[model samples]
Target: MRLAIYEIREGDEPHRLAHRLLGDFRRWTELVELNRLDPPYIANDPAPYRARGLRVLGPGDRLLYPYAGAVEPVGEEDAEAETYGRDLLLQRGELALMGGTVAMVRGLENLRGALERRLRTRLGELPAHPDTYGHLLHQYVGRAGGEAELRYILLEAERVIRQDPRVAGVRLEGELLDGEHVRVLAYVEPIPPGSPFPVEVVL
Candidate 1:
Protein backbone atom coordinates (compact mmCIF):
# COMPACT_ATOMS: atom_id res chain seq x y z
CA MET A 1 0.00 0.00 0.00
CA ARG A 2 1.43 3.36 -0.96
CA LEU A 3 1.27 5.87 1.91
CA ALA A 4 0.58 9.60 1.97
CA ILE A 5 1.12 12.14 4.72
CA TYR A 6 -2.03 13.64 6.27
CA GLU A 7 -1.53 16.61 8.54
CA ILE A 8 -3.75 16.62 11.61
CA ARG A 9 -6.17 19.51 12.11
CA GLU A 10 -7.64 20.95 15.29
CA GLY A 11 -10.32 18.75 16.91
CA ASP A 12 -9.44 15.98 14.50
CA GLU A 13 -9.90 12.31 15.47
CA PRO A 14 -8.87 9.05 13.83
CA HIS A 15 -12.35 7.94 12.85
CA ARG A 16 -12.94 11.25 11.11
CA LEU A 17 -9.62 10.99 9.34
CA ALA A 18 -10.33 7.43 8.29
CA HIS A 19 -13.80 8.23 6.97
CA ARG A 20 -12.63 11.26 5.02
CA LEU A 21 -9.63 9.41 3.65
CA LEU A 22 -11.15 5.99 2.95
CA GLY A 23 -14.89 6.14 3.57
CA ASP A 24 -14.63 3.55 6.35
CA PHE A 25 -14.67 4.53 9.99
CA ARG A 26 -13.58 1.00 10.95
CA ARG A 27 -10.28 1.77 9.31
CA TRP A 28 -9.36 4.11 12.17
CA THR A 29 -7.21 1.26 13.46
CA GLU A 30 -5.28 1.36 10.20
CA LEU A 31 -4.34 4.99 10.62
CA VAL A 32 -3.17 4.28 14.16
CA GLU A 33 -1.20 1.21 13.10
CA LEU A 34 0.60 3.00 10.28
CA ASN A 35 1.45 5.90 12.55
CA ARG A 36 3.06 3.70 15.26
CA LEU A 37 1.45 5.84 17.95
CA ASP A 38 2.85 5.18 21.40
CA PRO A 39 0.16 4.75 24.07
CA PRO A 40 -2.24 5.47 21.19
CA TYR A 41 -4.14 8.43 22.65
CA ILE A 42 -5.47 10.80 19.98
CA ALA A 43 -6.09 14.45 20.81
CA ASN A 44 -6.32 18.05 19.56
CA ASP A 45 -4.55 19.92 22.34
CA PRO A 46 -1.86 17.36 23.22
CA ALA A 47 0.18 18.91 25.99
CA PRO A 48 -1.70 17.34 28.94
CA TYR A 49 -2.16 14.17 26.93
CA ARG A 50 1.55 13.81 26.30
CA ALA A 51 2.29 14.43 29.96
CA ARG A 52 0.39 11.23 30.76
CA GLY A 53 2.67 9.16 28.50
CA LEU A 54 0.12 8.95 25.72
CA ARG A 55 0.75 9.26 22.01
CA VAL A 56 -1.39 11.65 20.00
CA LEU A 57 -1.23 12.57 16.33
CA GLY A 58 -1.95 16.11 17.36
CA PRO A 59 -2.58 19.22 15.33
CA GLY A 60 0.12 19.91 12.73
CA ASP A 61 1.47 16.36 13.12
CA ARG A 62 1.73 14.44 9.84
CA LEU A 63 0.48 10.82 9.63
CA LEU A 64 0.40 8.14 6.98
CA TYR A 65 -2.64 7.64 4.77
CA PRO A 66 -2.09 4.72 2.50
CA TYR A 67 -3.45 4.87 -1.05
CA ALA A 68 -7.01 3.53 -1.24
CA GLY A 69 -7.18 -0.31 -1.10
CA ALA A 70 -3.70 -0.56 0.35
CA VAL A 71 -4.82 -1.67 3.81
CA GLU A 72 -7.09 -4.67 4.08
CA PRO A 73 -10.24 -4.31 6.20
CA VAL A 74 -10.31 -6.01 9.60
CA GLY A 75 -12.30 -9.16 10.39
CA GLU A 76 -13.68 -10.32 13.73
CA GLU A 77 -11.45 -13.40 13.84
CA ASP A 78 -8.37 -11.45 12.94
CA ALA A 79 -5.78 -11.76 15.71
CA GLU A 80 -5.03 -8.06 15.34
CA ALA A 81 -8.61 -7.34 16.38
CA GLU A 82 -8.71 -9.98 19.11
CA THR A 83 -5.57 -8.76 20.89
CA TYR A 84 -3.73 -5.53 21.58
CA GLY A 85 -0.43 -5.38 19.64
CA ARG A 86 -1.08 -3.80 16.28
CA ASP A 87 -4.59 -2.83 17.34
CA LEU A 88 -4.00 -1.72 20.92
CA LEU A 89 -0.38 -1.55 22.01
CA LEU A 90 2.74 -0.92 19.97
CA GLN A 91 5.04 -3.88 19.35
CA ARG A 92 7.62 -4.46 22.06
CA GLY A 93 10.46 -2.75 20.32
CA GLU A 94 8.51 0.13 18.82
CA LEU A 95 8.19 2.03 22.12
CA ALA A 96 10.11 1.80 25.40
CA LEU A 97 9.64 3.24 28.87
CA MET A 98 13.24 3.41 30.10
CA GLY A 99 15.46 3.43 27.06
CA GLY A 100 17.12 0.90 24.75
CA THR A 101 17.12 -2.96 25.12
CA VAL A 102 13.32 -3.20 25.16
CA ALA A 103 13.34 -3.95 21.46
CA MET A 104 14.00 -7.63 22.14
CA VAL A 105 11.20 -8.42 24.59
CA ARG A 106 9.29 -11.63 23.88
CA GLY A 107 6.08 -13.46 24.85
CA LEU A 108 4.60 -12.72 28.28
CA GLU A 109 7.29 -10.17 29.06
CA ASN A 110 5.71 -7.91 26.47
CA LEU A 111 2.20 -8.55 27.77
CA ARG A 112 3.30 -7.78 31.32
CA GLY A 113 4.56 -4.42 30.24
CA ALA A 114 1.41 -3.72 28.28
CA LEU A 115 -0.87 -4.48 31.23
CA GLU A 116 1.20 -2.36 33.56
CA ARG A 117 1.12 0.46 31.05
CA ARG A 118 -2.66 0.68 30.90
CA LEU A 119 -2.80 0.74 34.69
CA ARG A 120 -0.23 3.51 35.01
CA THR A 121 -1.93 5.80 32.48
CA ARG A 122 -4.91 7.88 33.49
CA LEU A 123 -7.81 8.12 31.06
CA GLY A 124 -8.45 11.85 30.47
CA GLU A 125 -4.77 12.26 31.15
CA LEU A 126 -4.04 11.04 27.64
CA PRO A 127 -6.61 12.88 25.56
CA ALA A 128 -7.36 16.37 24.23
CA HIS A 129 -7.80 19.27 26.65
CA PRO A 130 -11.43 18.29 27.20
CA ASP A 131 -10.81 14.79 28.57
CA THR A 132 -13.73 12.72 29.77
CA TYR A 133 -11.81 9.62 30.90
CA GLY A 134 -8.51 8.52 32.45
CA HIS A 135 -8.04 8.94 36.16
CA LEU A 136 -5.29 6.59 37.30
CA LEU A 137 -4.53 4.91 40.66
CA HIS A 138 -2.03 7.56 41.68
CA GLN A 139 -4.67 10.24 41.31
CA TYR A 140 -6.95 8.48 43.79
CA VAL A 141 -4.27 6.96 46.00
CA GLY A 142 -4.34 8.30 49.54
CA ARG A 143 -5.22 7.44 53.11
CA ALA A 144 -7.55 4.50 53.14
CA GLY A 145 -10.88 5.35 54.68
CA GLY A 146 -13.53 2.98 56.03
CA GLU A 147 -13.96 -0.51 54.61
CA ALA A 148 -16.95 0.57 52.54
CA GLU A 149 -15.06 3.51 51.09
CA LEU A 150 -12.09 1.37 50.06
CA ARG A 151 -14.38 -1.19 48.49
CA TYR A 152 -16.14 1.49 46.48
CA ILE A 153 -12.87 2.95 45.25
CA LEU A 154 -11.54 -0.41 44.12
CA LEU A 155 -14.84 -1.23 42.45
CA GLU A 156 -14.51 1.94 40.45
CA ALA A 157 -10.99 0.96 39.45
CA GLU A 158 -12.14 -2.50 38.41
CA ARG A 159 -14.80 -0.93 36.24
CA VAL A 160 -12.22 1.20 34.49
CA ILE A 161 -9.87 -1.72 33.96
CA ARG A 162 -12.67 -3.74 32.42
CA GLN A 163 -13.07 -1.08 29.75
CA ASP A 164 -9.79 -2.04 28.15
CA PRO A 165 -10.48 -4.45 25.29
CA ARG A 166 -7.39 -6.47 26.00
CA VAL A 167 -8.19 -7.09 29.62
CA ALA A 168 -10.40 -10.10 30.16
CA GLY A 169 -10.14 -10.20 33.98
CA VAL A 170 -8.98 -7.92 36.78
CA ARG A 171 -8.21 -8.85 40.41
CA LEU A 172 -7.07 -6.14 42.78
CA GLU A 173 -5.20 -6.63 46.05
CA GLY A 174 -4.34 -3.78 48.35
CA GLU A 175 -3.40 -3.08 51.95
CA LEU A 176 -3.49 0.12 53.93
CA LEU A 177 -0.07 0.94 55.30
CA ASP A 178 -0.05 2.84 58.59
CA GLY A 179 -3.48 4.21 57.65
CA GLU A 180 -1.70 6.74 55.45
CA HIS A 181 -1.03 4.99 52.14
CA VAL A 182 -2.60 2.15 50.25
CA ARG A 183 -0.41 -0.22 48.30
CA VAL A 184 -2.31 -1.49 45.29
CA LEU A 185 -1.56 -4.80 43.67
CA ALA A 186 -3.21 -5.43 40.37
CA TYR A 187 -3.58 -8.72 38.56
CA VAL A 188 -4.77 -8.83 34.98
CA GLU A 189 -5.40 -11.29 32.20
CA PRO A 190 -4.45 -9.77 28.88
CA ILE A 191 -5.82 -11.11 25.60
CA PRO A 192 -3.65 -14.08 24.82
CA PRO A 193 -1.06 -15.74 23.13
CA GLY A 194 0.96 -13.43 25.28
CA SER A 195 0.00 -15.60 28.22
CA PRO A 196 -2.98 -17.59 29.39
CA PHE A 197 -1.86 -17.18 32.99
CA PRO A 198 -2.71 -14.04 34.92
CA VAL A 199 -0.02 -11.40 35.29
CA GLU A 200 0.70 -9.43 38.43
CA VAL A 201 1.56 -5.76 38.80
CA VAL A 202 2.01 -3.33 41.68
CA LEU A 203 0.64 0.13 41.10
Candidate 2:
Protein backbone atom coordinates (compact mmCIF):
# COMPACT_ATOMS: atom_id res chain seq x y z
CA MET A 1 0.00 0.00 0.00
CA ARG A 2 1.11 3.55 -0.80
CA LEU A 3 2.51 5.40 2.21
CA ALA A 4 3.18 9.13 2.66
CA ILE A 5 5.12 10.75 5.51
CA TYR A 6 4.43 14.30 6.74
CA GLU A 7 6.42 15.72 9.66
CA ILE A 8 4.59 17.25 12.60
CA ARG A 9 5.06 21.00 13.04
CA GLU A 10 3.42 23.51 15.41
CA GLY A 11 -0.24 22.62 15.28
CA ASP A 12 0.77 19.10 14.24
CA GLU A 13 2.95 18.14 17.19
CA PRO A 14 0.87 15.43 18.86
CA HIS A 15 3.87 14.31 20.90
CA ARG A 16 4.06 17.60 22.79
CA LEU A 17 0.34 17.61 23.46
CA ALA A 18 0.40 13.96 24.55
CA HIS A 19 2.84 14.75 27.30
CA ARG A 20 0.82 17.77 28.42
CA LEU A 21 -2.45 15.85 28.27
CA LEU A 22 -1.59 12.28 29.31
CA GLY A 23 1.66 12.69 31.24
CA ASP A 24 2.74 9.30 29.90
CA PHE A 25 6.09 9.17 28.13
CA ARG A 26 6.50 5.46 27.47
CA ARG A 27 3.16 5.10 25.72
CA TRP A 28 4.09 7.96 23.38
CA THR A 29 7.23 6.12 22.31
CA GLU A 30 5.25 2.95 21.73
CA LEU A 31 2.98 4.78 19.32
CA VAL A 32 5.98 6.05 17.37
CA GLU A 33 7.52 2.59 17.05
CA LEU A 34 4.18 1.05 16.04
CA ASN A 35 3.97 3.40 13.04
CA ARG A 36 7.60 2.43 12.16
CA LEU A 37 9.05 5.85 12.95
CA ASP A 38 12.65 6.30 13.99
CA PRO A 39 13.38 6.95 17.61
CA PRO A 40 12.50 10.60 18.26
CA TYR A 41 15.34 13.10 18.63
CA ILE A 42 13.50 15.07 21.31
CA ALA A 43 15.31 16.78 24.19
CA ASN A 44 14.51 18.65 27.39
CA ASP A 45 16.85 21.43 26.21
CA PRO A 46 15.98 22.97 22.83
CA ALA A 47 18.92 23.12 20.40
CA PRO A 48 19.56 23.99 16.74
CA TYR A 49 18.28 20.63 15.52
CA ARG A 50 15.09 21.19 17.49
CA ALA A 51 14.86 24.66 15.95
CA ARG A 52 15.53 23.29 12.48
CA GLY A 53 12.43 22.78 10.28
CA LEU A 54 12.85 19.11 9.42
CA ARG A 55 11.93 15.87 11.19
CA VAL A 56 12.51 12.37 9.87
CA LEU A 57 9.48 10.03 9.79
CA GLY A 58 8.94 6.34 9.13
CA PRO A 59 7.18 4.19 6.52
CA GLY A 60 3.80 5.29 5.04
CA ASP A 61 4.53 8.91 5.83
CA ARG A 62 2.77 8.47 9.18
CA LEU A 63 3.93 10.26 12.31
CA LEU A 64 2.89 10.00 15.95
CA TYR A 65 2.16 13.03 18.11
CA PRO A 66 2.53 12.70 21.89
CA TYR A 67 -0.77 13.47 23.60
CA ALA A 68 -0.65 13.06 27.38
CA GLY A 69 2.34 10.73 26.89
CA ALA A 70 0.51 8.68 24.24
CA VAL A 71 1.23 8.98 20.55
CA GLU A 72 -1.70 9.84 18.25
CA PRO A 73 -2.24 10.66 14.59
CA VAL A 74 -1.96 14.32 13.61
CA GLY A 75 -3.62 15.61 10.45
CA GLU A 76 -1.96 17.83 7.85
CA GLU A 77 -3.80 21.02 8.86
CA ASP A 78 -2.85 20.60 12.52
CA ALA A 79 0.85 19.82 11.92
CA GLU A 80 2.20 23.37 11.87
CA ALA A 81 0.89 24.99 15.05
CA GLU A 82 1.13 21.61 16.71
CA THR A 83 4.88 21.63 16.12
CA TYR A 84 5.54 24.55 18.43
CA GLY A 85 3.25 26.32 20.92
CA ARG A 86 3.39 29.55 18.86
CA ASP A 87 2.02 30.90 15.55
CA LEU A 88 1.71 28.38 12.73
CA LEU A 89 4.94 28.02 10.85
CA LEU A 90 4.73 27.78 7.05
CA GLN A 91 7.94 25.89 6.21
CA ARG A 92 8.96 23.28 8.76
CA GLY A 93 11.04 20.13 8.89
CA GLU A 94 9.12 17.32 7.15
CA LEU A 95 9.52 14.26 4.90
CA ALA A 96 7.32 11.90 2.83
CA LEU A 97 7.33 8.38 1.33
CA MET A 98 5.18 6.72 -1.39
CA GLY A 99 4.43 3.15 -2.57
CA GLY A 100 3.03 1.22 -5.55
CA THR A 101 -0.49 2.03 -6.84
CA VAL A 102 -1.06 -0.92 -9.20
CA ALA A 103 -3.28 -3.09 -7.04
CA MET A 104 -4.52 -6.46 -8.39
CA VAL A 105 -8.03 -7.85 -8.05
CA ARG A 106 -10.58 -10.25 -9.68
CA GLY A 107 -13.91 -9.57 -7.95
CA LEU A 108 -15.33 -8.71 -4.55
CA GLU A 109 -16.35 -12.20 -3.46
CA ASN A 110 -13.20 -13.74 -4.87
CA LEU A 111 -11.06 -11.21 -3.05
CA ARG A 112 -13.03 -11.79 0.14
CA GLY A 113 -12.42 -15.53 -0.08
CA ALA A 114 -8.72 -14.97 -0.57
CA LEU A 115 -8.47 -12.68 2.46
CA GLU A 116 -10.43 -15.04 4.69
CA ARG A 117 -8.22 -17.94 3.69
CA ARG A 118 -5.00 -16.01 4.22
CA LEU A 119 -5.94 -14.55 7.61
CA ARG A 120 -7.40 -17.73 9.02
CA THR A 121 -3.98 -19.38 9.02
CA ARG A 122 -2.37 -16.38 10.75
CA LEU A 123 -4.95 -15.13 13.27
CA GLY A 124 -6.99 -18.29 13.93
CA GLU A 125 -10.71 -17.55 14.55
CA LEU A 126 -11.35 -13.98 13.31
CA PRO A 127 -14.35 -11.81 14.17
CA ALA A 128 -16.92 -11.58 11.39
CA HIS A 129 -17.97 -8.15 10.09
CA PRO A 130 -15.87 -5.80 12.20
CA ASP A 131 -16.87 -2.66 10.24
CA THR A 132 -19.26 -1.38 7.56
CA TYR A 133 -17.76 -3.51 4.76
CA GLY A 134 -19.57 -6.82 4.50
CA HIS A 135 -16.44 -8.64 3.29
CA LEU A 136 -14.01 -7.57 6.02
CA LEU A 137 -12.91 -9.59 9.10
CA HIS A 138 -11.04 -8.38 12.19
CA GLN A 139 -8.34 -10.08 14.26
CA TYR A 140 -6.34 -8.85 17.19
CA VAL A 141 -2.65 -9.85 17.25
CA GLY A 142 0.09 -8.82 19.70
CA ARG A 143 -0.73 -9.17 23.41
CA ALA A 144 -4.05 -9.75 25.18
CA GLY A 145 -3.92 -6.38 26.97
CA GLY A 146 -2.60 -2.99 25.73
CA GLU A 147 -2.68 -2.04 22.00
CA ALA A 148 -0.92 -5.24 20.93
CA GLU A 149 -3.77 -7.16 19.28
CA LEU A 150 -5.30 -4.28 17.26
CA ARG A 151 -5.53 -5.37 13.61
CA TYR A 152 -7.96 -4.50 10.78
CA ILE A 153 -9.15 -7.03 8.21
CA LEU A 154 -9.36 -5.70 4.66
CA LEU A 155 -11.12 -7.46 1.78
CA GLU A 156 -9.19 -6.83 -1.43
CA ALA A 157 -12.46 -6.58 -3.34
CA GLU A 158 -10.95 -4.62 -6.22
CA ARG A 159 -9.14 -7.68 -7.57
CA VAL A 160 -12.17 -9.01 -9.47
CA ILE A 161 -12.81 -5.85 -11.51
CA ARG A 162 -9.11 -5.35 -12.12
CA GLN A 163 -8.50 -8.85 -13.46
CA ASP A 164 -11.40 -8.69 -15.92
CA PRO A 165 -10.04 -8.28 -19.46
CA ARG A 166 -13.16 -6.33 -20.45
CA VAL A 167 -12.57 -3.79 -17.70
CA ALA A 168 -10.08 -1.03 -18.46
CA GLY A 169 -9.53 0.13 -14.88
CA VAL A 170 -10.72 -0.40 -11.33
CA ARG A 171 -10.62 2.14 -8.54
CA LEU A 172 -11.10 1.44 -4.85
CA GLU A 173 -12.23 4.58 -3.07
CA GLY A 174 -12.07 4.93 0.70
CA GLU A 175 -11.01 7.03 3.65
CA LEU A 176 -8.44 6.47 6.38
CA LEU A 177 -10.43 7.97 9.21
CA ASP A 178 -9.18 8.84 12.67
CA GLY A 179 -7.94 5.91 14.79
CA GLU A 180 -6.54 4.05 11.75
CA HIS A 181 -9.98 3.07 10.48
CA VAL A 182 -10.65 2.51 6.76
CA ARG A 183 -13.84 2.45 4.65
CA VAL A 184 -13.82 1.23 1.03
CA LEU A 185 -16.28 1.65 -1.87
CA ALA A 186 -15.89 -0.18 -5.19
CA TYR A 187 -16.39 1.30 -8.69
CA VAL A 188 -16.02 -0.60 -11.97
CA GLU A 189 -16.73 -0.11 -15.71
CA PRO A 190 -16.42 -2.26 -18.81
CA ILE A 191 -13.75 -1.76 -21.48
CA PRO A 192 -15.64 -3.18 -24.54
CA PRO A 193 -18.28 -5.75 -25.50
CA GLY A 194 -17.52 -9.39 -26.48
CA SER A 195 -14.55 -9.29 -24.15
CA PRO A 196 -16.55 -9.59 -20.93
CA PHE A 197 -15.31 -9.62 -17.35
CA PRO A 198 -12.77 -12.42 -16.92
CA VAL A 199 -14.02 -15.54 -15.14
CA GLU A 200 -10.65 -17.07 -14.39
CA VAL A 201 -9.39 -17.02 -10.79
CA VAL A 202 -5.70 -16.30 -10.12
CA LEU A 203 -5.54 -17.51 -6.55
Each model's number of backbone clashes? 5, 41
lDDT of each: 0.55, 0.32
Worst 10 residues of 1 by lDDT: 80-89
Error of 1 at 96 (Å): 5.4
Error of 1 at 129 (Å): 8.8
What lDDT score is found at residue 93 in candidate 2? 19
Q: How much is 27 displaced in model 2, in angstroms?
A: 2.2
> What ranges in model 2 sit over 4 Å off?
1-7, 10-17, 20-23, 41-55, 58-203
TM-score of each: 0.44, 0.19
Best-matching candidate per TM-score: 1
- Candidate 1 stretches with Cα past 4 Å from truth are 1-107, 127-133, 136-140, 194-203
Give the Cα-based TM-score of candidate 1 against the true structure. 0.44
C-alpha positional error of residue 87 in candidate 2 after TM-score superposition, expressed in Å: 25
Error in Å for residue 148 of model 1 = 2.5
Across 133-191, the per-residue lDDT of candidate 1 in tens digits comes to 34455645564465654565566456545544345577876655545455556677654
